[model samples]
Target chain A: MCQLLALSCAEPTDVSFSLTGFAARGGLTDHHVDGWGVAFYEDRACRVFVDEKPAYRSPVAEFLKSYPIKSRNVVAHIRKATQGGARVENCHPFMRELRGQQWVFAHNGDLQPLGDANEPEHGPYAPVGTTDSEAAFCFIMNRLYAHFAAQAEMHADVDDIDAVFEIIEQATRTLNPYGIFNFVLSNGTAQFAYCSTRLSYVIRHWPFSSARLVDGDLSVDFAERGTPADRTAVIATTPLTDEVWTACEPGDLLMFRSGALLRRAHVPVPDAVLATSKYALSELSAVPA
Target chain B: MCQLLALSCAEPTDVSFSLTGFAARGGLTDHHVDGWGVAFYEDRACRVFVDEKPAYRSPVAEFLKSYPIKSRNVVAHIRKATQGGARVENCHPFMRELRGQQWVFAHNGDLQPLGDANEPEHGPYAPVGTTDSEAAFCFIMNRLYAHFAAQAEMHADVDDIDAVFEIIEQATRTLNPYGIFNFVLSNGTAQFAYCSTRLSYVIRHWPFSSARLVDGDLSVDFAERGTPADRTAVIATTPLTDEVWTACEPGDLLMFRSGALLRRAHVPVPDAVLATSKYALSELSAVPA
Candidate 1:
């Protein structure tokens, strides 16, 4: 397992505090010491910084902690090397170009039947690395390509983003039988998050207050950096700050845009996992959307 | 127009020295101050550093000068916008994935008939930014995909790289009439460069000596950082150091791998440019490869 963090905001906001706390888990506070990566989206394009070195000690990570590169959508990950070696290619937050948009994806959990020599069946998209996370990302890209291949010239016509989210939901549900499929994906238009085992999120709006980091001694008052109309949604594998964070129930798929919840759907519990974590589920599957 | 620089080495080598001199052009010595970007390849993957700010004054560019990140294949570009606005998305050294390899490209000249909104017909590839350079790159990628999409399994069987080079050559020839289209492309396996207006290259091998930067007041001895077996081939829009560099004839396409020249082919001169620079061509078209 690893750590995942994502942020969606109404306005482009710097994520220095969140990244500093999250990077500590790569080598300082916790043991996800394999590699780390982050993608910051700006106007359909993205700037990705990845390091095979443990994030806590990486020079790039150190630089990013102080550099305030603002972005509306950002995805970050710290890996523990569950599937592949500690090579730069195996780092998380894999990216691809589709429909004239730079799409980013990162997985926090391991998947089975991957990390082998043989690649899973995919179209147009292929994994450049050997990790299950990259393979899973490519699988989602392939699914999206297949869904829109029949469309006309305007492939970027993802005006109805919910329809795109549904495809991502189905894609995650299809890979549920493989193993933990918790992941975060984005294409600057929206942020999609799927939780199979563990995930949490917090939204900060107008009345922002100070919050202390759970892993470090640093604290920041959101009011100092945000305006009355600003809104920001932060998602992570575990709560990073001493603020109220709603724990995402297993099999929950959440979508956010402009720092607000766009949609929420409870995934249908797979038959294979029905017996193992039954007690973990108090509500029935397909609760609401 | 923009400035482009690329390196292909027998072993992983840090490009800090070259980057220092080249980055100076972004704001210090020259006027390519719109933005800058560089992609450093690490085993089939790459780390890209880009800044919308002037490279001479950017913090990221400052950090890179001191950092010794190494790579076997590297592509860098500093842009002066002509087709697109100075946004992060319009920065050069664009990247895409093809055949499970991270393909990178950087353009150094403006192209005509591509700035308008009507996108050229392409395959699965698309441009994320409104730049003629990226559109030209997508056109090349479409041609390559059209040539190889018919292969059965094993799409990565690019053993016949010459055939791949031929496709790129033809693609360049097809777009030759547009305007200046100098570019450098790589997938870690090999480096391909095409010159339509201006390009130059120099190879440093055994018994390496010192050289001074033409754009800066710095000098370095290659023997201090290289072994006898180390061979570094550098291609740039202009020679960064005061070393002997071979000027590439217009319409020349060069392929290199492991720091050694593989092949070179001169594209047939386009009828549009035949009248303007006929005196420049001393050799016939289709030069020895």
Candidate 2:
């Protein structure tokens, strides 16, 4: 499985502290170390750094640790390579442009046979890498494009946030039956996260307290580092900090905008769907020694 | 206006030497200091470093200068911002995914009102930035997509390099009628350069010689640095080094692959096209103080 880290904030925030702990999992702590990538969204554009090297050892990651590139929306991933080879093209988070907005996505867990079946049917948005994660992202993008195209034909303004969330929630539900499908997606303005097997998040706001990393001994006092108006939501496959991180129920789709959770859809995983998730069953049996 | 720098090589090579001098033009040497960006292609993926800050002073650029990230294809740009605002989104070179390959582009001259007219008619590919350069890129991409789509419908293989060049040459010629449209573009494997006003290039092979930067007091002994197998083609809006450089004639489109010139098309500039190029006229008058 891979690990994902994402941040959404009311004000632009630096992710160095959180990224330090998360990146350690690539090689120093846990064993996801196939490759890694990180993206920082600034307005409508994003700057992405990806390397086919362990995040814990990459010089680029080291520079990022100290550079403190600030952004309101950030998504990062460290891969274990469940479905793709260890190449730069296979690194997450993958990015593509749709409707003049750059969209970024990072996925954890394997979709396997489901992705292979669905990918060939998708068009206009196609995978550039031989990864199940990229195929899933392309599938999602293709669905969104088709939905918007149909709406445009009817001369309808499809910018409704609720409608967008509905479509995303539906797509997530459909993919959940395939395998563990935890992912974070953003369009620079809003963040959407879906939990399949494991995911957690924490919101830091006024009167912030000191937080310590779970993967490392590093600590930071947000009260001293942040402004009173600063509000941030950080989501990770596993909690990066020893803070009050709330675990999302399986099949929960959460939407965040301007640092606040604006909407959520709880589409509980059915027993039949869970039974068909062969990759998740294999994951259970293949637990690290 | 902007400054364009690109390198295509037979083997993966680091661009620290040439980029050092080219980046200095962002502030220390010349006055195109609005923003800067550089992209290095690794296999099918690319790592791009962009900052709204001047390259001479940006910490990111400093890291790049010290970090010898190697690649077979590289493109860099320093923007003067004749059209768009000095924002991260407006920074060149802009990137977009096309045909499972990331395309990088940077323009050195303005297209003005013509871009505004042609952009709306283009579909599927659209510019995220308000810059004429991006509009031109989107227009070109849209045209390529349309051409390839038509070819696919006709059951024709669209991988013909000659046919691809023909289409690109046609697009470049059409844009030249608008204004001075000098640009460099690449899709990782090949580099395409078009010169409407000013551009120069140099190819270094087996008998490598010592070279000195024209913008800075830096020199490098290529003989000591390169191997017999190292063949590199460097293209820039202005000659980056104190060496024998071939200036591209007006309306010349050159294609370079594996460090060798693959094709060249000479479509001489028309007097009417030159007379209407107001930005080129202003550029001639504003010759750096």
Candidate 3:
């Protein structure tokens, strides 16, 4: 239904090179051309650029290509409009502020029934756009807020990372039954990715080598561009560079902080859900190009 | 401490002409060189450009000057950073989402003790930056959410405009005692402006005349650019154009919807507070150049 890209780094780094190749998929190399968006975090604050235009031809995207806005965390998306109109509001990554922090999310797959069935209860978080992806994000945020509220009522601190991870994992597992639900989320400090069927990531560190884009005639030598202490990771629906990309399994949830993988959990898909997944696969395979 | 600019219009209009003159104040004309930001709303969605660099010299601002991104509501700020560091996080205008709508705010005055004294209690909204402006915004949002929650619990619809206006007015009155508190706020549909000491506005409609920038060598004939149906209202800390501008009185709050003034109120300022306001005026007058 769409494509997602994300980067997390130990130091603030520019993503122009990677973004150039990724943006090609917006209309040049692929057909996710309905709209596109990108968000970059500078410390605890974020700057977001979104356009209801093909990223490959958007003036804003072109400016960003030459302008080096460095960030520690970045999330981007190219939409094919599986369920929503091709309006500016339907563009990702969608952002909402929670617990005094801004959280950004981008989705790459469809979750059909979740859009209507999982109606968000009266809560502070709500979806402004009519997309299954945004509904899912709002649902997750509402759950997180509820969890925090419960913890606060008990007079306990809500910074327990383990507990938060468990809640997110449970929510992702519950939504996976509806359909493919691959997504990336961040709160300026850490990034979380959940793979339902298709996702890959690559980590780069010292002793880096040059890499070429798989889709475009572009290449960058990491050794020339980064310092010896630099560490970075890029995540995408499909690998953008000719590098070692690790394929995430069907139900893998990965947590990353400071460019390093912090945790991984393999949540098994239910047998009944797996049996009906052929329809989901066909739905994804039918993405327009 | 900062300069604020906003536009509300019946039609989607480009603000490049006014923005050119306003941006000059960032470094070229006056000195609000700490940072600058602008937000444009497209329906319920928004695109914002912010830079820690001075606006007059920032490549991002230069790109914006030529890019024709049309919006019905827009807010811009050039910061002098009276209370916060010159970082991206401290830049205005700040944004948060509530009730599925994005709310943007920019402040042009100081609230000295309020920044530290009014530590936000545990709430759904909180400041991500260490600025008095952001703290004030959070305080307002928290109050709005509380009012909405109470209304919901009582089985009342939360869209009563009068009630919402009263709540906002009361909040602004409460903050005015802390220090100078001029601000502009919008939720993509309507705009709210409050003037503690200095602000001005101009309404342009049919039979529009030529206008010249006060801060730069630029002029525009609105009659040549806009249709007879076009109506626009521009608000700024100081008049941007050499036209008949209406000065907003001290403690004046104006609400605008669809480029027309919808409501106005003059909350009384305390005599003691007014006596201490001379220092605030001098601080603003001393803005570096």
Candidate 4:
């Protein structure tokens, strides 16, 4: 498995502190050395940066650690490469535009091979890379697009974003027969997360306190960063800080909008399916050598 | 009009030298001072960086100047907002995915309003921002996708990329009714440039000589940076160097692939339409004080 980190805030906020700790997982504190990517959302647009180099070693990542690019929503991933090579295309997160809104996605788990092609061919979802994560994102996007097209109401029903949210919950269930599919997707307005194997999150709001990094020595007091009016939700494969994190069970699909926990839809996939995950392969990787 | 720059090379080459001079135009040597963007392509996937801030002041642009991010295809734009607000989404070098390949476009001119909506609504082709440039891009994409769908051969006909090339050429002709439409489009393999007003290019090959930047004091001996086997084509809104640049007349659609001139298709539009352009607004803007 790789590292997944996402943040949704009430206001445009910087992710430099959390990014510092999250980036450490790439060849610093952990062994996810394939590549890393980050997306910072600005309304309907997002600026995405991806590198084939390890996050801890990438100059882009280093610049991000100091650059205060304020955004209401952010998603970052450090990849270990389960299905694709360590190329720039294979790096997470992937970006696509459907119906004017730009979407970004990052995955941290394996799947039981969609088998569109043994070669790196983009069959239906149109993923340029060989990663199953991108395929899964496109699968959900196709489902959303088809949902509107089947109704012969591609334009009329688009304002109903809640419809898309339910479709995502349903699509995650359809993909359950694969393997661990923990991934985070965002559309600038909100962040959607599905927990298939391991995921945790912490919501910070009024009366915030200082939090120390779990992966590094850096500490940031929320009081110094902002007033109590600010709110945010930080999600990751594991807790990135020493703050209290709520561990999500398998098959939990959550939505965070404007730094608030909008809702949660638990896709009840059986626990037995997690048995087929690429646990053996991930465990065999050399850690912090 | 804004400045546009593109590079197509036989090998992965960095644009540090050209970018350094180009970045100077944003709030510096000359006044475009809206925003700037760059897309470095690695096959179908590209790493795009855009800042709503002026390029000369943007830290991201500063980093790109020192960083050697090499790619076979690169496209960049320094914007002078003609239709949309100065925002990242409205930044040049907008990207969209079609057939799994990322297509990036940067336009230097305006168009007669494609009046689908009075507001910033994504009508028909689905542009998230209120820019005529994006609408034009989406319109072309729709025509291309419709061409495949109309034939009932969406998947099968994709292998014939030459068909897509011809379609793009024809589409450029169709868009000439719109006002000044100088733009560059790339899909990692090649660069397609359509010059509506002012544009020029230089092809560098073996036995390269020194060239001096017109916007800056720096000079570079390309022979030191490249070998006899290296070949590249650098296109810009105006010649960026003191070297000989073949000025492209209006209606010139040129293609450069793997450092070689593939073909040039001149889409002749009546010269009288340039009178209707937003030339007054551009000239009225304050230049370098």
Top-TM-score candidate index: 3
In candidate 2, stretches whose alpha carbon ends up further than 4 angstroms from where it belongs are A113-121, A153-159, A225-228, A267-289, B114-121, B153-158, B268-273, B276-289
For model 1, residues A136-246, the per-residue Cα lDDT tens digits are 888888778767765655554555688789888888887888777789999887999988877899999988899888878899998887798788999998888889999
Task: Single out the weakest 10-residue window by summed lDDT for candidate 4 chain B.
Answer: B116-125
lDDT of 4 by residue, A1-289 (tens): 7989999999888778889888989988888899999999887778999999999999999888768788899999998887889999999889877677788899988877766532223222478887888888878877766676565443546556678789899889888788778899988887899988778899999788999998888899987767777999999988888888999988899999888988899897666666655463346333221
Chain B TM-scores per candidate, in order, are: 0.90, 0.92, 0.93, 0.90
- Per-residue lDDT of model 4, residues B1-289, tens digit only: 6889999999888778888888988778777888999999987679899998999999999888878788899999998888889988999898876667778899888788866532223222468777889888887776665576565443546446567677788888777787788899887787889888777899999888998887788999998878877999999987788888898978898888888888888788656556655463345333221
How large is the i-RMS for each model, in angstroms? Answer: 2.1, 2.3, 1.8, 4.0
TM-score head-to-head 1 vs 3, winner? 3
Candidate 3 per-residue lDDT, tens place, B186-261, comes to: 8888889998877889998888899998888888998898788788999998888888889998889998877888
lDDT string, candidate 2, B30-149, tens digits: 878899999999878888899999989988998887789889999999999889899988898888776567888999887756634453334456677778888888778777767876
All candidates' TM-scores? 0.92, 0.92, 0.94, 0.93
Candidate number achieving the greatest DockQ relative to the actual structure:
3
DockQ of 1: 0.55
Give the range where candidate 1 chain B is weakest over 10 consecutive residues by summed lDDT.
B280-289
For candidate 4, the docking band is acceptable
Clashing residue pairs, candidate 1? none
Q: Weakest 10 consecutive residues, lDDT, candidate 1 chain A?
A: A280-289
> Per-residue alpha-carbon lDDT of model 3 for A166-282, expressed as tens digits?
778988877877767889998887889988877889999988899888878888999887787788989988788889899898789998877888899987766665565556555
